[model samples]
Target: MSDDLQKELGVVRDEIDAIDAQLLELLNRRARCAQQVGEIKARHGEAGFIYRPEREAQVLRRIQGLNPGPLSNENVTWLFREVMSTCLSLEQPLSVAFLGPLGSFTGSAATKHFGHAARLLPQSSIDDVFREVEAGHAHYAVVPVENSTEGAVGRSMDLLFSTPLKICGEVVLRIHQNLMTREPSLDRVTKVYSHAQSLAQCHEWLNRNLPNVPRISVGSNSQAAELAMQEAGAAAIAGEAAAERFNVPILVANIEDEPNNTTRFVVLGRFDAGISGRDKTSLIMSAPNRTGSLHNLLLPLAEAGVSMTRLESRPARHTLWEYVFFVDIDGHRDEPKVAKALAELQQQAAYLKVLGSYPAAVY
Candidate 1:
């Protein structure tokens, strides 16, 4: 290389190294701040350790609102999520198990939520994540709850009945899927591989564009990408992470039929709530068989000025007619009005369980 080119290369390499050192220092400072926050939380209660969703959403909005945009909105949100993850680690090293054979969306979700600090355990089955948490091998577990396209993850809801673990926080990941393959041309593609949900979300696109191509379901979109990397005439529908991991080319990007497609995931753990000025609480209850029972249950919440975010009914285990309602409400259980409402609710419900309240997850 010429002397001028070599000088330019040396300057770039030195600049990169300097940036790395600065990043390391910034990360350490962030970790220390997190430790202090954890200590403050612990002095109040144990529940301080768990995450809360409302806080996280609020943080994300605030970050976007203040961003000057050398980095995009998404980039800022991701950076904060990583900071939160690292901060949480300083309090204690947590092991979180999620549905995965690695590189699955669940794995990505777990890592994104936990940051670079937590030990992640990948399990093949959703039930296995529950099992690992239940057996004390993991501090927490993450499982898919609902998808914008296909609806609830039935197995996760069913497992909720069988396990003692409580939902600690929720994560909603925007789904962006791409058609990727080694085959360079769309004409060369004869088969598709992806998770069932991915296929369902892209149903219209697949039928309209590649009607004759056979679709095969796999455990995850990442797994499909792996298969595509090894097979000719095959393509996978998955996220950008999978594409980078598998080194496969994205033949068609954002193939998911719905632009607003998203998947909601829930965190399961034993920790209770630490007071976050803003928070939400989840409750499971069953009302009496008679008519005014459901109304009676909701009236107190309305009177308390609590907004109900989610309400879904599951068949009460071993009971033909009874149904349990899983509710997500906007306020901490410890709040004066919420406590009063729960007290009133206890009188009207056949069964009531107060799931743990934690510091709302913050971005």
Candidate 2:
């Protein structure tokens, strides 16, 4: 390197150091403000709910809107999310549970939404994940509800139908299923492993790359990573987190058949969130078992001028042929239009339960 170049870089380094110091000072000031807010809430005898889903979403969206960036909006949002998370922890660290063996995509979503400061408890099953929060052992739960490529997560949807936990927030994770193994190349891989959903997501890639390799479906992605770590001539289909956590080498990157493969996760909590301007309401309802009853059940949403975003159906338990409908609609449940639609919906439906309304995923 030339002396002139070194001198120029050294000047920039000094400026960066000064900026670092200022950031440290400002971060502490913000943290102190968070603590004061907590104290004030304590004085008022309010229920101490430190994690405000709507408030956090509003802040992230506002930050993204105001970004004048060399850094992309996503990078800026992530940085600010960490800062807010750190500040919130100064008030009270949260406990979040997810289905896992650590390094599962659900675990990543939990951290993405809660930040690393929150204590994350990994459970064996989706039922256990819900139980952890419902029993007050954990503050919240993050569970996958659906995927873009393969559709609904059946177990999660089934649990949501009965669980008392409310949907307080959501996360949308862009899935990048990598081929990871101890071997340097895919040629030596005799077998493949991954969760059923992940295996389905990468089906086309596997057919072209390893036509004869036996693809095994395991309980979770992390478990597949674990098997690959110990088994010879084996590879796992998982994400960066699993590869890193298990120290497996990634032989192929983003092997998902769909380029835009994504998974949607919902945060389960006991209480509901206040309205965020752009919000979504999720609910489960069943129509009367007569012809045209399902259409009648959904007519109120259109009549009230509320947009319906998603509609899914699952077989209702205890009834051989009956099914329940899961619906997502624009606007918070608190909004007048949404409230009116829901009121009308309640009158026409045989059964109805508003899972909860919350801020939509910021991304």
Candidate 3:
């Protein structure tokens, strides 16, 4: 090798080593601060759910805004998330529950919001995920409330209405659906396995490329990937986590009909999240059995100058005639305008429940 080239490489290596040492020391110092926080909280007799969702949201947003790096804001946020997660472990191990077999998008959401340092409890169903947190077996539950491609996840919404758990945070993951199989090409494939939502996301692709192949809906894409890993002439449509977890090789990548497919997942816990500047409050309300009841119910928000972001109707389980309306609004419930809207809404609606008010997804 050229001596000049070796000398140049050595100089860069020396700089890298020095930076690494500095980072290690800073990380340890942050960890010590975190431990001290936990200790101080304990001394004050206020230690509970040591993980703070609102504070974390504020920090992430601030760091992202301040980032002026060669690395993208996403990369910077991810690095800081991991660093914070590691430091939090020095205080207390955060526990999170999610819909699983461990490779589902829900699991990815949980890890994304809570970071990898949290103990993950994989539940078989969304109901199980909620029950785990409600029963105090887990610190928090993460579940997919909606997908951009497939619309609402009916089960999650239903559970959210009934569960005592509150929505404390949210994670938005950009989805990439891959067709993975052991087969060299699609020619030999006989069947495709995926969650129903994934199948719908890739519906056009499947129709064009594998029309004759039977598509089977499963409990999750992770389960689909597992089956594909062991079966002959089989392929699974799943996210990268499932593909990696089940050790399936991707033959075709990002086959979703919509190129910008994304899923929004919510964090559910016993406690509420404080107001972050940018926040969303979810609610379930019912209109009276009158001609203009629906419009009347929403009038409060308009009068208060509060913006309503989403409104969906579900069949009220208690009555045949009444419909339950799930609403998402722009501000936190505690904010003055939002609070005034709710105050007015309380008088008009037959029923009202504030599901949660949490910071909006960072990205």
Candidate 4:
């Protein structure tokens, strides 16, 4: 730590700063070119010029295919995701909404998908998220659809059944549950609080460590952290963001039983991802009650060479033996083959609702 050495180090840091500035300038220049491409498309009267998943995928894959540097596959994917997100924003700023109060996982996922620069709004409930997008208050809304540890988020499914909003995009987020507390000692911990799913994910840890302590379920993990701040004897199971927001110390990090725990969030918006040659269409249909009725309903898709991605049953709400099948299949609604398949499917279904067709998340 001599003065000469410090001066030399400072000079190196200045060079690093200069290199960073140049890199940023190059990025902006590239983004401007993307904006020009968008402008050209706009001048040609192309409808909805911003998003192009196929082209983006091709670009990223080409970059990865040609990459020779130290940057790994994931590094390149992340970098391009940000770069494309920024470029798209230049064409048109994306307005996104998510379940609110800031530090929630849905909020984090929304930010992750659209980037921090996108105009993000927070809604109080899942239905409100749909309403926001439907009412044109926001371009899209990110809502938790399902979790690996806890199955489906029922509220989102229910909203899907009721709302006209289409599923435009999807995001998968890794869930890490942290036990945060204000108490300095585990011995002083009297109670644990967290969201219902977080508690379930960390049930083994809670039972093993604080067997005698009572566990309470709060509205959200962030709320649990806030509760723990007021109650010194309590700890909260939540994400890292919650811990930082509440200024609670993380007692046990990554307490979820499964390390590969991830949640799938769906983006609902006024428009679908459009006819990207590769995509998935989600629909709700009810078949007549018969042994072969379900089989017959799916037969048309099979005949058309369509692949079903997901099929989940939910109660139809009105009658005693009635149910709605939420079907997701690999095809776009606008495609001729898919359109024909759906037309045939209608003959078999008592009720059919084409929820949406959107580009499947490539990851």
Put down candidate 2 lDDT per residue, 272-348, tens digits, no spaces. Answer: 78998999999999986888888888999999999888998888996443989999999999999999999999999
Q: In candidate 3, residue 104 scores what lDDT?
A: 70
> lDDT tens string, model 1, 107-209?
7778767777789999988889999999999989988877542233777877876678877776677778899999988889989998898898899999999
- The whole-model lDDT of each prediction reads 0.80, 0.89, 0.88, 0.81
Tens-place lDDT digits, model 4, residues 1-363: 999999999999999999999999999999889888888888899747476544664566677777787988767767777888887887888888888858777887887777666888988887788888889888889998775433337778878877888787777889898888999878999999988878888889888888899999878776898999998799988888888988999987898887888888888877667765567899989887777788888999999999998888887776433778889899888899899999999888888888888766644
lDDT of 3 by residue, 197-221 (tens): 8899899999999999999998778
Q: Residue-pair clashes per candidate, as listed?
A: 5, 0, 0, 0
Ranking by lDDT: 2, 3, 4, 1
The ten-residue window of minimal lDDT in model 1 covers 46-55
TM-score of each: 0.74, 0.89, 0.88, 0.82
CA RMSD of each candidate after superposition: 4.8, 2.8, 2.8, 3.6
Model 2 pairs in collision = none
* Model 1, global lDDT: 0.80
Runs in model 4 deviating more than 4 A are: 1-29, 57-69, 147-152, 275-278, 289-296, 299-307, 318-321, 334-341
